[model samples]
Target: MREDDWLAARFEENRDHLRAVAYRMLGSQQEAEDAVQESWIRLSRSDPASIDNLGGWLTTVVGRICLDMLRLRRSRPEQAVGEHSPVLADHEVPDPELEAVQADSVGLALLVVLETLTPAERLAFVLHDMFAMPFDDIAPIVGRSPAAARQLASRARRRVQGNPDIPEADSSRQREIVSAFLAASRSGDFEALLEMLDPEVVVRADEAVAARGAASLVRGAAAVAEHFSGRALAARLALVDGLAGAVWAHRGVPQVVFAFTISEGRIAEIEMLGDDDYLEQAELTIIEK
Candidate 1:
């Protein structure tokens, strides 16, 4: 067989697996099919000789594509559930067979839960927990260390299992961790801040915060630690949206909110919210330290 024919055969062999991976990453079957097709396009363009494991390589490519799609979906305004309901009134018959197959592959309830997770967390959980992919392979895809990838998967797993709410004891422990992080930031204790942060911790700010010259996104413990060192002196311990977090208030009115996602006793994600609309909608309770 010619090289192109051989490559086509190899790709055909892995199509179903790639489609399954993409479907889990993206809840929409149409999007999953698109992701798989894109992966095949990439494979065809690359030098096959360099690929020792085509299956693994294809999986990684599909993962990256799905992650991008998920992020893009999040960036846009959210649509209400059933907004895309089939327009059966137009006399278009729905395919019961196809619907059953899709439902059997992944339940709608689980997909709803997965949609709540961040792109990185969803990818980590789907690849490591669902597909049995190792964290080492997943780390590079999500741009995190192996340990951090594991943490993401663990956190996602907890959410997927319908245990999204932190237990009372876990909440108290998280409060202590957030308090320590605040103290370290106020005192410019960079080392201490690093200790409480995951090696691949991520910090994201809203447009309002970023407009003030703060980064929209920062990754890595060292970078995040450096950014927070000697800062947050005015930020007080608070509960933002029922999570252990902090708020920087002016005259008792919150000007900024720091929502933290803690896992494995380390801060895995921090979201800086300065948007007026979000602040107004969030339930903020300043905790007396």
Candidate 2:
């Protein structure tokens, strides 16, 4: 067999693991695929005979590329005109324990939490805590001293604990609560909705001009019910990121989607991403009934 063929075979064998690693670092599947593709291109240009451990080499290349992408993205200014935001997808995720050792961070909620962390802290924590890489190896990934990498990871740990975005709830219970929420929405039972909702709740619909910010929150069960009143919303229930959510369509076009974060059997937060951008990412087609 040709030397190029041999190198291609080795790369194909480790592509899945590489994709998983890149996905965790980049937070988007499309970008992750891009990182993996770039890594392979870099690998192809090098003499395969010189590389001893192909898997490790590929991972290091991908990790460094991802770090560069993150830094460049941070440095760029926000778009003054309409911007195209990458829509996040909800898929049938793998078991976290199985992927944890390999550094495949699976949950969307966890990814959102990671966004609060600095780029250096994220690299250190993902490398050391998720991938089991030592500080010595991670220091180079972030271009910091070994002691600095350790401190970065430590600081990240504290920030993650300080203001966690979501709370831990049993998966089964969360599903059940989501099911109840769907039933209530379909029936328009305000009492059931109130019972399921926590006294302090927040709802932010992406289509609303306010879109985001603390001031946009809809507090209290009464306010929650009032907001839903007089709306002609037709939705179907689905499991998104192992949590309950709804897909609302009007005139055969998907207009809104709502994903809830439940805690202690009450819905604590409701995140509504109503942009049609989700239609392409989720591959959803709204049909008129």
Candidate 3:
């Protein structure tokens, strides 16, 4: 094989791993794919023979790209979680790769918690904890000493494991409640939403959505029901991460995710994720009707 052909062949071997790392780091499928593509572009421009470990090189490159994107995201003020927008798909999604990602999606609750982490903290945690990258190797990517990187991961780990985003009920029941919530939402049935929510249900959204006058924190069953009534008509029943939730996909790309916190057959909390990048990074397992 020609040298270029040999190089391309080798890179293909690392595609899935690279995509997995990027998805965990960025939490968006499209962004992950973009990072992987950029890695290939970088490899194409470099002398592959000089690289001792192609996989490691590609991993770090994707990591760095994800880090930059995360930092940029942090710097920007984003819109609210659920809002009106023109349909981008403008009907159905039949992308096999997207379907595969959805089939074995990463946990939704975890991704929501991960978003709460800072860029450095996210990188450290995703690489060290999820991908099992050593802290020493991760240090250079986040521009931190190994010790600092370890600390970042440690902090992120604690938050992820103990946060409200981690639902404490049966997965199947959680899905049922989520499905009911979606049904209520699609039909704009306020009473149904109220029935599925606790008397003191809570709703949370990111600052980007809140900054645009969206409610970041909402409490009370009546109020939460009113907020969701007649919304999410475009969303489908899916597993957000491992938690039962709903996603609004345009054509095949997810535009929003409705994450829930359920307890005793009622939704205790609501997390509406509409940020474009965050939505893409989310792993959605569409449940069969």
Candidate 4:
């Protein structure tokens, strides 16, 4: 067989797996197909003799392409839900019997949660948590250290899980802590705020919030406490996506939402989201005191 023919056959062998990875990385099937095609193009240009593992090489290339695509998407204006829904080709209809099975296996809800993650965080979580890829392998792709890659996946996992199955008692405790944190912030009690936060607490803000003068990232309890101290007066206790959180609203519309990650009774992380698209998708309910 010709060299190009041999490469094409091998590429076909890995197409399904590559498509699956790309689909999960990018939540759009069309984009996933584009990424897979780009990977094949890269493979075709490279010398096959120098490649030890074509599958691994192709997967990494696709991952890098998807990462770039995700970053570009984030840079653009946010799209409203259902604005760019995927449309399948006429000849691409699936078996009726497999519809439910595919839907359940894909878990569209999980994909929605994944959309909230940053590009690096999404890559780390998908590759490490879902594909069993190690942080060492993910580090180079994300341009972070292995430890940093691991941390990204850990943070993403926490957000994705959101503890929907948390016990009522635990949920109540979370609410209490969130309430206390808000109270301390409103009262400008820096010490009280610090007490509620983990020593290594991290705070992240979505692009919109950051553009509105909020810091994109804040680390350490002291810094986080200082940032929130005397600042949540306009924010009210709320259940954000079934998790104990808070929101700041203007004329009945939420302008900012605070999602907290509580660990060992302390605030381990706080994600501030002000993106209209994200807020519209989130289910927020005010908790009356």
Compare the candidates by lDDT and give the number of the best one: 1
Tens-digit lDDT string for candidate 1 (1-289): 9999999999999988887788778866667779999999999999999999999999999999999988888787576423222222345454453355356645667777888889999999999987899988998999876645766787788889898676799889989999999999999999999999999999998778888888999999999999999999899999765578999988988888898999899999998878764576566789954
Report every candidate's CA lDDT.
0.83, 0.67, 0.75, 0.82
Score every model by TM-score.
0.54, 0.48, 0.51, 0.55
- How well does candidate 1 score on lDDT at residue 200? 91
Q: What value does the lDDT take at residue 206 in candidate 3?
A: 56
Ranking by TM-score, best first? 4, 1, 3, 2
For residues 218-246, write the lDDT of model 2, one tens digit per residue: 88878886665434256666554334566
The candidate 1 region of ten consecutive residues with least summed lDDT is 80-89
Rank all candidate structures by their lDDT, best first, as comma-separated numbers: 1, 4, 3, 2
What would you estimate as the lDDT of candidate 1? Answer: 0.83
Q: Encode model 4's per-residue lDDT on 195-263: one tens digit a residue.
A: 999999999987788898999999999999999998988899998766789999989889999989999
Question: What lDDT is obtained when candidate 3 is compared to the true structure?
Answer: 0.75
Error of 4 at 60 (Å): 11
Candidate 2 yields a Cα-based lDDT of 0.67
Whichever of 2 and 4 has more TM-score, that candidate is 4
- The runs of at least 3 residues in candidate 3 whose Cα sits more than 4 Å from the true structure, single-residue gaps closed, are 79-105, 163-289
Error of 1 at 271 (Å): 27
The residue ranges of model 4 lying beyond 4 angstroms of the native Cα positions read 1-129, 132-165
